[model samples]
Target chain A: MSEIINVSAIAKVEKEKIRKRIESFRSNGKATPTLATVLVGEDPGSVYYMDMQKKVLESLGGTMLKLTLTEDVSEQELLSTIGDLNNDDKVHGIMILFPLPKHIDEHKVAMKISPSKDIDGVNPMNIGLLASTSGGIAPCTPSSVVEILKDTLGELKGKHAVIIGRSNIVGKPLIQLLLREHMTVTVCHSRTRDLKEVARSGEVLISAMGRPKMITEEYVGDGAVVIDVGTSELDGKITGDCDLESVMKKASLVTKVPGGVGTLTTTILMRTLVDLYEKSES
Target chain B: MSEIINVSAIAKVEKEKIRKRIESFRSNGKATPTLATVLVGEDPGSVYYMDMQKKVLESLGGTMLKLTLTEDVSEQELLSTIGDLNNDDKVHGIMILFPLPKHIDEHKVAMKISPSKDIDGVNPMNIGLLASTSGGIAPCTPSSVVEILKDTLGELKGKHAVIIGRSNIVGKPLIQLLLREHMTVTVCHSRTRDLKEVARSGEVLISAMGRPKMITEEYVGDGAVVIDVGTSELDGKITGDCDLESVMKKASLVTKVPGGVGTLTTTILMRTLVDLYEKSES
Candidate 1:
């Protein structure tokens, strides 16, 4: 049987490190690492992500300021709210939950977030910095994937990594990170022909497509490292992109959903918050 | 014989369109579209590029402002010059020639150019915007590749494109552009194992790694559309990454050095200048 990677244990260790850092900040008479989350309209997914962020930040002895707005919040009002957050010294990091009311322009909102405070890496400057291998932080989900891969496989140089998504949040940033690590990266999406053939080429395969249990045994190459980043609710259960049971039989190692990437994602978010806080101080 | 794309003819046609636009602007009593270029030190290649830019802009009835600084120019001094250009009412666009001395930080220089006037798309904000498929402009080289591909193959959807470089200026941005066009992209670089095998997989192959004629006929798949973006001097003659004479025999369509992507690249730069000028007015 292939080893099922325990991501929760990894997250737990990361949380302990965050807790220690926060404690040190408190002892040193420094302000708590505070994250300001701006949420508009109650899209369940966005709301859920915000709550997870809050729980993780607060649990680490950090502060989370939730600025909840009505679904009909005007673009001006949203921008002004973010402008206020940008000026607020107490807020070290800022994250704006997406899918704001259709009338509001998401791109404009993304730009309004100050780069230093954009812990989620939504700001265009931050995204560009990541792309250029310059000074920008990356979004949490992609960062978690890199962290997991590095932790499992120490030397990634010359390794072939196939990422099965091309999203700005996950797939795109993951490509840059892997390339920086000296690995060959192939990005596949819905339009990709021979998806299974291409997917089988990766020594390390990452699935971020939101399809549940789509990547089955045939997609798995013998002894390949599989990472599942998709989360979808099916029959009152959380399912990942990979059919874990079938994949485990052929894979050397795999990360399960709900407890795998998700657990580590929140931890990375907290880490970014602390890092932003430290940067702000320096 | 494989079809050699007439990039010079295409550039001429585009230049005519630009000339007409400038005439229209002149007829309407508008200021001439002007581009400000910053060049530090006497790097022959950078100087040659600036001269080419000047020649092209002038040919299109546009103004080209050259800002020359010594090799020992400080970071603050260079940024101040950009700031002055940013405030100049006559300057519609800005381009900074790279390799800005070891002492001066290039990334900081990139960030200093205002996004609206960053015609070359050197600003991190623009880079990020392009990556996110948002409102940012792309650099000329990558844009030229897209133009050539779209011109050759009407619909790029489902095409397998393999880019053989990972530079922020070319390979990285090109991935986003191709992905936006619904093509599957695989990026292979120095650390990519089985480089030739990976390169042979592209239905459309693009080489931007400045190694002189490293990609031979073996790297070309049957009837592939090959694009050579690399230009390196070998024995006093400029050469490209692909062994063009051999690749031309195998590729159904190919772009040659000196007269291929480079010609279109300069034309696109002038196009971006006029675009920025129009954008500034609106």
Candidate 2:
């Protein structure tokens, strides 16, 4: 029987490290690292996510500054807010919540975030860092995948990894990280002609295509480690790209939709904030 | 018998397109795109490359601004020169001759070039664009790979591709591009275990690891399309990462060392210069 990889245990350990780091920073009177979460429009999902993240930061002894803007917030107004945050030394990290109003140019707003304070690591600087393999902050989702894989797989050197989806946030950056680890990594997306054949070849499979339950048993090789970064609401419940019920049966380790990567993502964000703070001071 | 992929033909077509585009831009009275080639030292290869590229641009009615600096040029001076070039509106692109002086921080210098003027597409902004998949100039070698793949494969959707090497210049960004094309892309490096198995599964195999003749017939499948992006001097002879004499027999299509991607790289740079000029004006 293949061993089950339970991330909750590892996540708890990492969380403690994050919490302790935050506590040390707080006790040192080095201002608590602060993240500014800018939300435009009222999406319940966005709100819930923001609140949960804020709480997570609070629990870790970090500060969360929530800036709420109306759905009709002009592009100029948003840009100004980001500019203001960029100048604020108190703000170590700034994240403009995704799914911005249609009228807003997301890329422009992203560009405004200071590369130094870009804890969410979605800014162009971080993206460049990933592309060049030089040191820079990493995008949260992909960084989390790297951390989890390292924890579960020990060393990724020479491992064959196949990624489903090529979204900027996950697949592309994840490929960069895997390359750094010296893993044989493959990225498959919508344009892919033979998905199953490609997936079956992986020692590691990462599903982040935003599709719900698309990966099945046929796509998995025996003893393959599966990480599902996809989050979709199916039947009023959150689900991942991999159909865990069947995949879990064939895989050595599989991350479930809800309790798997999603749980670790925000935690990683908090850790990134502390790291950024330390980096800034150094 | 598998048909040999003639990359030179594809490269010639692209070169012709660039030549035509430059001519068209010049005739339209558009700012004839100019690329300033900055050389820090007296490296023969660097000098040759710069002169060759300048000739290519000049033939197309574009201008080349040559800045030849002493080998002992200070970092501050180099940076200031880059700054000056950035402010020069007529200089649409800047190409820094590679292998700078030992004391210089190449990455910092590379980052200093304005993204709008980075015709070689080595700037952080372009690298960030590569990571984001939102579209930006890509490193010339990798971008050429993408261009060649599209011409040969029709559309790479769902193809299994493996890249050997993880250098910032090639492997990381190439993976991102391949992923963008909807191909299953894998990166394999020296630390990888079972490298042969990984290489054999790829419908497309790209060797960029700078190692000379590292990929042999044993490392490839029966009909894999091979792209060798490596340029190494072995015993005073230029060669690629693939053992072409043998691997060519196995590959359905193969790119030759000096005549393949390398020949197309400079033309792509010219294309990027024109592209930058167009983007800036638009």
Candidate 3:
């Protein structure tokens, strides 16, 4: 018989610790950690995410500064605004909301922000840090995924983790992080010949292919821990890459769609802000 | 049964093409390739390598400029020398030989070279380029390994490769390169448990650990393509990480100790210099 690992319980414990840390920092005379959210266009999902993030930070005794720019803003203007925030001591961390206007070079805008103030860790400097294995800020989504896994699995030293999806966001960075933790990681993408065979090799499975219920019972072995980082709207509701009904039976632990990684992501953003604030003082 | 793949014949054909390319560039006036080698001490192995590299470059019509610094050159002096090389218009690429005197900070010195002239690809800027997936130059040894794999396998998408050893020079950079090629890469180190099991899982096995003949027949899967990147002196003779006798039996394709990656590394270095030279002119 395999023991069932409760992912929600682990996430709760992490969230509680983060909440207490924020409170302690607030009480200590340190400036309340602030995250500046910059949006280039009218993205409904981005707006909703910003609002939810603002509420979460507020709950944790942190503050959010929103900067909305029109879609017509020139590239130079956007860069200038980012440069200003970089120089401002008040802004502890900066996250430029994605889905920018088609005309703008997103990579240029990302490079404009100082790496020290980059809460999203999408900047080239932080990416280099992750690749170099020297340790610095890491991409938030993948970093959070590892944190969740570590909290549940303890040390990941010898574990075999197979990742579905080879996007720069999740698969690439996650491979590097897992390597740092000494886990043997395999990444499969759309080009993979045998997806189920690859998934069955994993003691830990991470699905980030953005497909609704892509991972079925065939992809999972008994006692496997599955982390679904995909969120797709199906039938007017949120669904994940893993088929919960079938995968849950085979998985020792599993993360649900709306309640799983999405919740931890914003919490990680708050933590990034706090980390930046502390580094500034030190 | 899985189909057996023969890699050595393909590698030889590719090697011949690469050799011809080097020869054509050497005789042609269009690309004047040059590599500058900087050596600080008088180590016997380093001297032999430096001499052999010079001969190889000259044979390929590339010029090699040797700069021998004193054993006790100050950090400032070393920096200034590298600065001169950075500013030299004739020098297309610069490489600081390994095992500098104990007084100098190797990382600081490596960082000082202009990224465009960093033929070795150890500079932070080039590292950043590789990390960002923007296709920048890479360290010669790992770069050669990837080139060999791709030349033999023909686009290594979704291939499972496991690399032993986590040295900055090989393991980390190789992961970045393999990820770029869309191969799922796993890196294992001294701390890794069940090392043989990990090595056996790889369809492509890269042994970079310095221990001579460390990878045995048991660590290799049938028909696995093996690349031995280690060069160690065992009983006054050069030996590799893979046990040639046993590994050759299990491996459908294998690179021997002296004739394997070592032969290709300096050739790759010359190729990198030619690339930098062309980029500079453009």
lDDT of each: 0.91, 0.84, 0.82
**Best-to-worst lDDT order:** 1, 2, 3
TM-score of chain B of 1: 0.97
DockQ of 2: 0.73
lDDT of 3 by residue, A72-118 (tens): 99999999999999999989999898879989998898778898898
lDDT of 2 by residue, B1-282 (tens): 555567778767877887788788778777778889999989999999989988878876788999999999999999999999999888888888889999999888889999878877677778887678568677788888988889988978878888888777787778767767767677788887888888898899999988899889899898999999999999999999988888977888888887888877877777788788888778
Fnat for each model: 0.91, 0.85, 0.42
The pairs that clash in candidate 1 are none
Against the true structure, candidate 1 reaches a TM-score of 0.96
The interface RMSD for candidate 3 is 2.1
Clashing pairs in 3: none
CA-only RMSD, every prediction:
1.8, 1.9, 3.2
- Give the RMSD in angstroms, all C-alphas superposed, for model 3: 3.2
TM-score of chain A of 3: 0.94
All DockQ scores: 0.85, 0.73, 0.50
